[model samples]
Target chain A: MPAKELIRLSGLTKTYGQGDAAFQALKGIDLSINVGEFVAVMGHSGSGKSTLMNILGCLDTPTSGVYAYENIEVQKLETNQRSMLRRHALGFIFQGFNLLARTSALENVELPLLYRGLTRGKRHEMAEKALRSVGLPDKLRNKPSELSGGQQQRVAIARAIVTNPITLFADEPTGNLDSSTTHEVMTLLTQLNREKGITILMVTHEDDVASYADRVVCLSDGNILSDTLNNRKNNK
Target chain B: MTWNAFLIALREIRRNLTRAFLTVLGIIIGVASVITMVTLGDGTTKALQQQISSLGSNMLMIRPGMGFGPRSASAGIPNFTMDDVEAIREQIDNISAVAPVSSSQMGTIYMQEARSSSITGTTLEYFSINNWTLAEGRYFSSSEATSGAAVGVIGDTVRKELFNGEDPIGKKIRVGSSVIEVIGLLKAKGQVGMGDQDDCIMVPINTVQRRITGYTSMHNIGTICVSAVEGTDSDKLVADISSLMRQRRNLQPNQDNNFNVFDTRQIADTLSSSTKTMTTLLAAVAGVSLLVGGIGIMNIMLVSVTERTREIGIRLSIGALAREVLLQFLVEAITLSCIGGIVGILLALVICLGLSQLIDIPFAFNIQINMISFIFSATIGVLFGYAPARRASRLDPIDALRHE
Candidate 1:
């Protein structure tokens, strides 16, 4: 009920199996993310970070607990209803830069907008604008294979923000890039967050990657180890 | 949404054009063979029917014994004689003309050329019964018939073979030690009923019996061709001829009549129906290829779904509905088969044309068959395509994303 708590998770539990084979990935975790916040979740391997990210991104259901986005009950929404939420409210970028192969960059960026019922002309215009904003207007017709890794990830970024989603999820987005390219991508994300006021939630293991977020949430063995506002990274 | 799906389908096909073409090959061969068989069969039947119809619907051929077809013979039955022909011509009402016909597969004949051909012996009345119009010269004269004149008329093939386009109106040809002058040259009437009707020569029945073979029984003959005058009932004429033959053969009520009277129209009908049956059988056999082709499409689609699991995951994450993915794959299947159908139709056209010309029958394009094969292939796409498309749509997004 805080002034701008856009996402709230309370007593969230996600287990992998039944009986003796059961693996509880997240154990009664509670977290709140405010509007326009860039939050990075960091943890070691087997620390339940990916499971928690999956739940927060609405890509997976929790075994038990409450998940609400903007006060709407996400845990209770049906599959299609959840799909609708994802379509209208969320955008995702993957570690692999999940661009469709054999498709041009502009077409890849236009993919999300196609489901939003935009006219053909509007879809093209917005896709071109999104590509230009990501600094790839000249490479609009280049396929993923034709572009470098940094450029491909830029196309994926354009795809993510083209629909003007309420929240963006980046899963180890810079993990596949070189150190210099990673800096560029990180700069692009910070620029998008500062200029567009888009709430960003990223999952990463690197301290350098997490250093760009306004806040950091650290998990250890299915439980939150630390949650702290990062004065060093906060742009506002 | 469908338009977007269609575009996706088009892009997918274009991405792997070779695989798409191979996937549709079964349909192409299927439709091509089917159209070829059907078109040629119809052409042959058409040509036969036209030839028989030109022979006149009202004509009946009375032969020895009760026979269903040309080669079938009712054993122990006697052959016909000229007395039967004369009796029918004089006693039967509605009878316009009647002629006794005899034929022999004679040995090689020589004059200007040497060739062996069937020799038909009949009178000028044979012309009227068969409605055979002369192209040149004249028919049999009564004096020539009574005196057994050694004169003949050559059909187109015999003219080509022995005459070599030389005027056969007065030239002489030798037939197994007998010499005959070609007094009339018949016009080109192509193969009718059976083999080449133009290959054989026609002469007076008397000339054949007395001069050629020396079998001089005046009443004995071979086949009788009879025609009815206008305004006569077919059934009545058949009954009149049957009763007359029965009486002439001296068959009691318990005994079987030894002669056969056949309607030309009935033979034409039977021939065409049999051809229709053959066409249906051939088309059905070819239809199985279409089924296999559909299955090929489904198999490839299932493989495609597996191959693109992560791609599908990306689409789902990007907010594509399950049905949209389903529609996209379904469109691809339909597009594949429909293209195959179109190619099959074009291939069939070329094949049918070549075959019709090769077999010397008229090429008949049946629009109904074209429509049926086209729609049937399209339906095959939809029916076999749904299973794989549905499998793609029902894929779990999490698992799909995890799939390598």
Candidate 2:
């Protein structure tokens, strides 16, 4: 298939609070993410990067804007519809590796598939495959506390991708990991993006983490400061 | 969602065993207390009814007094003698048998030793009226009663106390310095109407009145036992006997009947109804404890919601519907209470068993009531758990994720 836009946003603006206490988090953001693209969003603290990620991940709605995923306007969707969209179309990876404590890796991966109402057999099959893809097949029965930080993030990734969603949204996916584990997680993400053709959006403050992406976008004070395609990295 | 998540939740509950047990304790105590109270109350009522029935269903007691009150000095108590008993027997239509008894606790002789026992002076009609049967020998004859002979029947308790397992029939016993031959030994009558029938020694009424007490007329007759004729309306019989006694005493129409008449069946009904009322009142009080248990569940669920804030955020972010989260927590609360209720029922059963063995009353454990209580407690868990579950479900994912 031709390069189709999986996520599209136009003139997106999000404001917290109201009247005198009003604060704008995102200012007229316009962006499009194509299918199978690995894009990185970089910004300083309080630079609207996290707000854009939140909107992109469907965790929040923009104060004023149009957000469309796969040709469907997400801002106008109902609460249940948004939940369904998140389950069937978009996946999220948090910086804290927000895996349920005391839950096994396979069960964590099966969480999203449970919302999809899959049968027990089918859920196990999908969760096993997802864990295997993240290179943690042996850690399926281990809880998050038992796994290394990178292993926990892999379990989180397995959970996000188990539903085979249209877009994967990762916010500082390696923020809690050391340099070695960060590289290992980023390599896994790169391999998943290239081999499975899954669209990836990553947010980070580290330039080294952003360097793994095919395209990099920088934001400052609620405005996009740069949007550049990495032709050299793409060629390599 | 997946059964795995439910399994995980259950596992988590098991892991925090102490908290789970504490959470269920309220329900356990509430259910157990209800069951114990109901079982014991039912048993006592049944025992009382049985005791009343054993006294003869149609038997009525008539005593010379204004209802049940203290005896007054100015009240001219009518004498109930062999003549009055004969008069009532010959005059009344519903009277099947009449026994005019004069009783006193006398220092009597049994096996050559003096012992304290009741002496009742009455006719042979007393045997049939009180459903008494002879264990050995025969009752006093009408000739012996009329001739004022000193023949008497001894109850089983008196026989045991006096003879010490030997036969007392044809043996002579002394009552208040008067020697009387035991004509028979009565069959064991456990106890009836607050008095031990087995401890009494019966003699001819005229003989006891003339020889032992040295009185020709007895003022206070130990309750006159009357049995109604077959197919006769007992209430009407009682009313007729009351009127006849009043006329015999020469009371005016406006005056209250000077004698108190109590029917065994009526007393039984009254006792049962009162017991039913008491059971209902105790159940209502126990129900209040169940309500408090529900409130305890709600309070704990609220705290659980607060504690699991981050977990709720994680689940929501992973595509869990708000209603799904609500339902999971609700199920958890219900599970806790249902487990507690089951334990309570078992405890109640054990308690009922212990009570039946320990007390004189028969305690019955109604399975239907126990089941109803169990279901009621589970429902309370659900009803109370809803608010906290809803609060957790409606939480903003971003804010919840940020919650410490």
Best by TM-score: 2
- For candidate 2, write residues B240-347 as lDDT tens digits: 878878877778989877677778778778878998998898888877877776677666656666557777788787777787776666666777888999998998
Candidate 2 falls in which docking quality class?
A: acceptable
Measured with C-alpha atoms, the lDDT of residue B66 in candidate 2 is: 67
Clashing pairs in 2: B43-B362
TM-score of each: 0.80, 0.80
lDDT of 2 at A188: 86
lDDT of 1 by residue, A1-236 (tens): 44599999899999998999999999999999998899999999999988888777777788999998999988898767777888888888889888888889988999888877788899999999999998998998899999999999999999999999889999889989998999889889988888998999998999998999989999998999999978755455
**Model 1 chain A lDDT-worst window of ten:** A227-236
Against the true structure, what is model 1's DockQ? 0.48
Model 1 clash number: 1
Residue A23 displacement (Å), model 1: 5.3
